[model samples]
Target: MGKEFSSVPMYTESAEVTKSFDDDGRIKRTGTLLTASSHIITAVIGSGVLSLAWAIAQLGWVVGPAVLMAFSFITYYTSTLLADSYRCPGPVQGTRNYTYMDVVRSHLGGVKVQLCRLAQYGNLVGVTIGYTITASISMEAIKKSNCYHKHGHDAHCSEPAYPFMIIFAAIQIVLCQIPNFHELSWLSIVAAIMSFAYSSIGFGLSVAKVAGGGNNVRTTLTGTTVGVDLSGSDKVWRTFQAIGNIAFAYAYSTVLIEIQDTLKSKPSENKVMKKASFIGVTTTTIFYMLCGCVGYAAFGNDAPGNFLTGFGFYEPFWLIDFANIGIAVHLIGAYQVFAQPIFAFVEKSCQKRWPESKFINAEYMPFMGSHGFNMFRLVWRTIYVVVTAVLAMIFPFFNDILGLIGAASFYPLTVYFPIEMHIAQQKIPKYSFNWMWLKILSWSCLVVSLVAAAGSIQGLAVDVKTYKPFK
Candidate 1:
């Protein structure tokens, strides 16, 4: 929220800092608690937040909020563990770990490093695809909102999502030029603002719906009525999918070390990051509670997968239009936030493999001053964006995609690795209370991840029956 308004932090420009490099010889760590918190918020409250009402609708009144809280605590706790691992021997003085995989390699080496790469980068790629799908959904929702404004809510106002996906991809193609993770704090701040704008609008709209009332919605303690709203198996699958949705909503731990690496070294990075994580997670939990609970109350079992874009509040057409626009813009920044690590990895790998190849190693376009363009980077990143956009177009089932990403990411990145690393790093005795409980938590989350995945696969299978790809 503190975006440095009219006055840029004097330290923002490199000329002012006494030192140009930290112990790692990279750019001096200038990020504050506020900046880190902004990044965390931008990462955590992403496109996945749009589906919470649907998730809550699946879990019902009691379980939905409860599940949200449970995930929140788990995310915050695991994030602290991850933050501590950003350094090797100890929290404060140990050598820095530059990426999530580095942290894994340092703490628990060998095969776990490969596992970290698979989970972290895989989740980042999935998040990019999910963001593309979400951005397109919002763009189509904007067009639909305008149509509803001109005609009526009941008008045949369907729009094909593919074109919007293309438009979103093109925008990302340009923003992807920003190069890497270091320059993204401003973007993160902007994205966080957009997140607030749309989420608040959704909450306000939902509250209005509940207040200016007729008996329009039906809610129960457990969730959707089994026989009436769904079959027994459907009830099971959707509930699991909804749990996955909640898990996705709380996902940012995978990037905690990278974000922490940005912090100044004086105050230990781990300490600052824990505070940032707490602030970010707590802030999103409040918004998530308000938006998800009120949205569910407004539409009950019929709640749309997207609060603003699902045509729930058509009368405030202009407001809905603005909210959807905010979504598209926020995702433009978020796509890069999740994608930059992937970009750095790929570029670094390619450069290493072909050290003599000019295409990979040489820099072009010096107009941006110190940071010149690289041909391979430009081409590969563009292709990455295009591929994700194409995948979004092929399968635009929003809830299912989000559920699958969440289930795939939440346990491995958010829970399992952090806990494992913490245990290994601290050298906790084999059967101590802390170690035993951490093991239990990890196993429990793994089971949750499995079921959530099954539920997502089930949903996708069902959706695929009638959904023609690229149609």
Candidate 2:
């Protein structure tokens, strides 16, 4: 990765410098509705969606699809509220808040900003860890799938996720060099396509199985029947855990304002972002409905965590392997999508705190284009990736981890912050209908998040007792 660049050059402004900047005096944000939607899709439809079948299986026919729709609606509505917060005081004329933290600090200044920062970044870190585990499992699935194709379906072909986790981390370390969310358009597009590819493949395979009529399809109205499937308490925990999984699938608001900051102020950033959210959430919901509903139909209560990678479809192993490949490739981009904000935060903070530090401020630019190479970014980002990969290896339980992350972050980042910001920004009356309903909604989500978190913790405890680390 060494570049033959000379010493750091002196800074000078030129006519050809394209010195245009956004209202915030940063680099011009050229992101369009399409690109914003692309970023949203990449963030929204990820390893989280791959587990929806299992979530649906837990919730069953009516509740499963209904929950998916409910989340889609909630996500879109809150996303619009978040969009307006991208600019304070006014939707278009107000000053821009660069990241989610900036939006919180602008509207709900105080410890609330720190709380938002913690939940936002903490959730981002947890998501990166979840992605590492999911991507490694996808990589391992390719190997196991090919083995099943060559040998018998019942053949022993399992492999440890450690090697694949390392591989995923290495790739993310390289991508972390992309610098910021504004520079990730191409990656977001590629990752969005990959998400759609794998989701479609999973949906198609499930539909095919249902049409085949060979496999026994078991189902229920309210989901896993009590006493028949498990004890009453187990059902309660799993049901709540499943809700967390669905919540995770709808999670993208942690970066919503960040993504909004990338838009050009024409028809207004808030307007564009709202449209993008509608498009993104609507498209994501369609995919979720198709994949989760049909996968549940195909396997009923026995639907695996991942229909493709969970050995639900052994025949036509090539397609399964391809879907798994899609998952890994998509996660390669999604990880960067989530990780870039953290990278930017830490780097910006260090530079702000130590403006005179050469290691933090100076950027070595190679002869090719305007890209700058900073030692701090390189080393720190690599360390971040490595730590997440290590954590993923230490705890590879996918569903439980996803549920935990989703439950931990869903309310504060997605629901509570946006509602509070909106109520403050719009100056909704204290005892007015809007304020009352908004408070009710936020409280309801908080309850759901807490219950789901408890369920995930219980599930993780159970898994930890039985599973050995690094296996």
Candidate 3:
């Protein structure tokens, strides 16, 4: 008798398979769904949440929310447009897989790609430095306030304490190195809950203080009468600069590509992206409104400290303690997100330099060791912590460092990346531009990017010039 053959389907490379890895490289089944609310909550609640109120204070209550909302809309529109137009790279890869540079290279040629890469790298480094500074300062504030209370004045509490900072940085770095978004998703949720609680509590406290006949000196809105004196060209210039600053402050959609790649389903991913952005912006807008209303109402123009901190009637020690702890956690979360690209870039650079090193070998010295804890990550994190701690000690002023970092790092990532991606995607013949809107947005982005970059440079230069050794 002839051999009977049973019919069966054969699996092939082209067939869809379901498997995944988290940042820690633990394997899991694919097709998990992350909701829009969750994604938005995560995207919005980061280091910026604490600082946004302060940034708005410089403009006063009337202008702050307006600028924030407008900038948010512009950023949202641009980001969504870019996402829709560009062909984002595969899931497993990070943002480096198809950066703004890659898009430019595909459409605008290699030279532009190089330029974009340079810009991207500059932006990344600036952001890393900024986050580090924010994180270290936050930790220092917490340690000085809490640790000293728990310990004593004799306890070592100094800004140059790099070792402590390194430990915190390692925690952040490891959280970031987790290969999967599933684990990190919880971070956003926790941050959002804390942020909302803080903002609500802070706002209530500020309002109560104002209502109870606290110092509430109002400032005149007129330009000439006040020292602002924005008359003629100077007025126009300041407005332009303010707009640029606004754009820099609000443009945070640079992570869209990564967010898109992280999602398992295309439709869900797009929905989450939009939802996250909307939630983030809306939450921010509300917080700004509440803070501005109550803050300005209480402290007015002569607000004693940074407007955010100064608004409330609480004692300095109390406010600082709460802020310190909250900000520390938020900053650590941010560091995790930001560090992914930095580590990836380092790995890529190392691989390029030593082609025969077999550095990519899984069995080789892991970028982070097999277990989440290791010396390799510890060393890199220590370096990051030390550099930032040193900067904090030298600068000693949070507002200036924040502004410098905001302009240098956040501005480019938020403003430049979207526009560049938009322009790059325009090269596709089928893509059409809304001539009027495009022109306006393009000009706006260009002007804002230039101003922010210039401002950042000036701010950094001022820091350098004013530098004195910490006592």
Candidate 4:
């Protein structure tokens, strides 16, 4: 037999080895790559996309896609940079690995923290208000459509719309009152599916309509007609307004840290999270592009609230009804996603004051000896619902109020917060100040947000003039 020497064990005290393997002995926990396509879809598919078609149509075909692309690029780059800087866990967690106030406190000191908190409070409130209003509009649309079909005219439809608003508001408030936010994941999934279905079908039909040489009548362009002219001061205003819209689209940076922390493997979690961001953003952009193009093509002048106007003339009332249902469901899901944190914050504040109340539990009643439902949660939820309902009813136009809040809150939350946090963490040197591009972009977002907010407020005031009593 050939002499076989036993292999000597190689030992080096200073050398360390970490071995990881998958089921097949390949590297374990390798980062999963999310396609850019999926990310674009998720990032752009929110409530704002519903209105993009109308916004784009106002700019005309030549300017619409160009402006949207610019906004999309800004949104994507800002989101990616913020996600990288904070290494946020993700949206699943209530608080990001770092809260906005904490980041402000660290980077800019205590004074900035107070300011950041104020901004955060405003941002959250604005989001809540926006979601509520959007949901309310969907409710109004459904009620109005139903009433019109039943009575054959716009008359006799107004009372039902307001009551339906209250009913929908109450339903949303109840859903949000649930303590476990994660349970709402199913709703998000369902919303995502509905969005995909609706968008895809609408996209297909729109393209088919175009191909069929459908007569596209250009509505009479006049200053008297709201959102008809794509020229003059309106064009400039729209350009600025797009900033707020874009900012709102990317304002959820705080949730990213929570998502990152929740990942099973810390070492490769950033990679995976980045991959997801890429997928979400890319996919969202494509959907938005399609919506913008198809919507404008379909409805040149009479675009309904947003994309809906594009489909208003399409027959088969059931299809429109189904689309409306999808919108309602999607809005509900979006509302809950933002509402959970606010609810938790309110709940915690209440518990601190009234430790004796039994309403803190899931039973919907006060603790064993308590006389009524947790008065705190009840009051809080009711107030939130009432205020939002009143505002929505007052400003029934879809994008006006929603756009304002979105613009006002987008900059501080998305751009400023991340930069503050990264600086706080010392991931970037404080005095070095090398990142000129980010500083410029941040300031650009700030300016745009402010202008958009002003415009939205003005738009709301203008819309209020058109409000009429219930018929």
Top of the candidates by lDDT: 2
Residue range 1-471, candidate 3, lDDT tens digits: 122222111233344444544332323313223433444444454445444444444456567567667676776776665454335432123222334455555445656666666666665555555556555655565556555556665666554535545666567645644643445566755655656665665576667667778464664342112344333543333333344444434535544555554554434444555656666677766775676456556655444333333323334455656765665666565555555555556555654575444223122234444423333334555566456556545555444444444555444455555555555454433335554556566666556556655654554565578666554
**Candidate 4 Cα deviation (angstroms), residue 365:** 10
Give lDDT tens digits, candidate 2, residues 1-471: 445343232222332334465555555668899999999999999988888989998888888899889888888999999999988888789988889999999999999988988899999999999999999999999999889889998899989889999999888888898867888999999999999999999999988899999787688988888888778999999999999999999999998988988898787999999999999999999999999988888988888887778988987888888899999999999998899889989988998799878777767764566678888888999999999999999999999999999999999988999999999999999989999999999999999999999999999999999999865
Better-scoring candidate (TM-score), 2 or 4? 2
Per-model TM-score, in order, reads 0.95, 0.96, 0.74, 0.75
Query: Between the candidate structures 1 and 3, which one is better when assessed by lDDT?
Result: 1
Best by TM-score: 2
Instruction: Report the poorest 10 consecutive residues by lDDT, candidate 1.
Output: 1-10
The lDDT values for all models are 0.88, 0.89, 0.51, 0.57
lDDT of 4 at 261: 33
Better of 2 and 3 by lDDT: 2
| Tens-place lDDT digits, model 1, residues 76-143 | 99998999899998988888888999899999999889988999999998899999999999999989
Going through the candidates in order, what is the number of backbone clashes in each? 0, 0, 8, 32
Better of 1 and 4 by TM-score: 1
Give lDDT: candidate 3, residue 391.
Answer: 57
Instruction: Tell me the spans in candidate 1 whose CA falls farther than 4 Å from its real position.
Output: 1-18, 368-370
